[model samples]
Target: MVAHEADYEYVIHKFETEYYTYDPEDDSEVKPGPNTPDINPKDVKKLPSSFIPEVKNECAQIFYRFKCPGSGLFHCILTGLVFDMTREAELLYKIIQWDESVLQPAGKMAAGPLFDIKCCEDAVRQLHFPHCVKTQEALLSDGLLSVAHFTDDAMSFIKPLKITDTHVIVDNPHLSAFGLVLDFLMGIWNKQVKGQVLLFLSPPNHAKQTQNINVLLLPRNIPMTEVSKHHQPSHFILVPSACNLIKNTTYTVHCPVANKIQPKRAEFDMEFGPNYSPTFVIRLPMNTDEVTLTIRDQTDTEVWEHEADLTDHLPFSADGRIPAEKIMVMLLDILEDLNDEEFKKFKWHLKTEVWNNISPIKENYLSKADRNDTVDLMVQTYEITGAVQVMENILKTICRNDLVKKLSTLRH
Candidate 1:
């Protein structure tokens, strides 16, 4: 007799905090405040239990748990999703990748990440998902933006109860995979929206005398913090520019100095997601220090252009001993172990000039600087080798012997 067997994959997430911090207002402006009529103040006896879920897959699939004490508004830091809980319950939710082509028949395209939420039926009174719309001048007023709910092998669109600057609020009668979509049939394809162009350069292959550069075309609403967290190894080139892009329009990147460029053309798709793939890639000679990048539309008209210098953004030391990204990763890992107070002490011990250069934007670096920001500042101010030495001395001085040992071991 033959035996039948099946295999299942499971992802587990653990949280240490009893209740996550609930700020009344955040810089992102993605969450609705208590005074918002959507949330009743009386239901919020305590802040709703929140967690930042860990990514489980390369596609950035995340799994988390929301343990509600009674009933209140819960916000997700990653996907900008908010839940209004009606009763005490534990909810398991995740952001999953979907085949966007399914929406073609509906004459719509995705504008945000798709979320799969599971909990007791009717436990959630409403769900608010962040949208990429830059303004409500025409899209919202014309009723082109809506939520796509997938259930029982079928998809349906839901009109939002309220549309704000950051989020689209919808009533949650049934829990399933939901995402934000725009109906192109409603003349959305002809309209241009605010966009951004980001550049990332890979470490040069000295042996082959070649390098690769990635160009990303994204909506202006996507947070830089999220993009930086996902792309750690590549050196991000800061060539800021205002861009206006049309959805589904073909765009071509031209670089005269590049050795090779792939695809020749790429369609501009609005992707607000857990995964951000490069729009175009250009290959150049290792010694080519500067290049002129131009993005032209299908009509052969230049839409965005920039000249970026490759010297400062290169991720290597003068002697090519260690890559800056490696040192950055090591420093980030070490700093993660330090508490807020310890981190403050470490910063206080730094040289005056170094501190000033690290945080030129703010007077109080400790309050605004995060682990990535600190590591980036250290690497930028001091090269790879100097950054390593400074971090080692600070770790030792802070009495974080464990982190110091780890740093030394990793450095060698």
Candidate 2:
């Protein structure tokens, strides 16, 4: 995460009390009387909660406090004035502390005490609102500290660290993704001497609420074990898109000591590539009406593209042999019932059920194929499991027990 420019400085203010005890208001901090004000702490109850009385004649030490309102909107009492603290204020509070130089002489040991503002007339505007408002003008006119000027001076002293948010394009391009994350981490840790750090590991091109797809939400304070939970071998694959995957999708696959495929998968196209590596290309027969591609890894474990979508290419294994025909056959059987509306309802229910498995609805990687679309188009994209389960349930509902039994036997 990048720090913002306003994060470096902590704002400090000093309040002068003319009355020993007084109520706080925008224009004044004393009783509404013609008599000049004076500081008398015996009437502490009348002071704002943020103010603290001096102890043992320690003039150099004063105290104050601020609060963050849930609305992100801050307002004042004098004619209901308002101002917003920048989001970067969080970093300021986290990194810096109050300085006591304002109260102490050069030789005295500074006790960093928070400062309070009198008249409450001072109003500091955020970066977004540069010009002074009516309340600020009132404070300035009285030679009183206005919030706007205080914020301006404090912000000027801030020097935030530069951070750049970027995306890693992984469309099966020539780049090796394995080392990218490691290098990124090294750069961040090495460059910044101190601060909170977070690294998000998003999923492969799946958008979620307010966040882009495939992005992780990692905070520096998060436990290491939790951070590892989102890790996947695929994160290291730098492909332009799912369809553009090639043998060199990741760097780890090319390790000389690693289990090697006799012929490199990169040498072939989608139709004839070896699936012993991270990716393979399969060329469906040009004239073929339907196709299914079941991919497996070196462990002989089948790989499922749970998030397959109409926009993605046919699914293939990360390694090992590709079972293209088996998936196609199952899909073709479903196409036989394409005209059935009840079958369409079953698909909707299935998608919803799969989606609801997570507490909040996450990105739906499963293809949203419509019955009105060509059977070939639907068959080419969806994973065999979700499509088959929806079809089998539909078949059973329509009293086609015979077909359901056959599907159960042939689920690959």
TM-score top scorer: 1
Q: Any runs in candidate 2 off by more than 4 Å, and if so which?
A: 1-167, 170-181, 184-319, 347-351, 355-382, 397-399
Residue lDDT tens for model 1, 1-412: 0001111100000010111212246232233234434332223332333323333233343355656555755655444567778887887876667677898888888777677899888688888776667644544444577899999878888877766565677889589999888887777665777687877787788998999888888876554434544555677664544578988899999999999898789998888766677889899999777899999999999999888766535242222212434556778888888888887777677534342123222224334556765664454344344466678678777788788677765433
Model 1 clashing residue pairs (backbone): none
- Model 2 shows how many backbone clashes? 35
Give model 1's TM-score versus the native structure: 0.56
lDDT against the true structure, each candidate: 0.63, 0.24
Q: 179-225, model 2: which lDDT tens digit per residue? A: 11111111122111111111121233223222111211111111222
User: lDDT value for candidate 1?
Assistant: 0.63
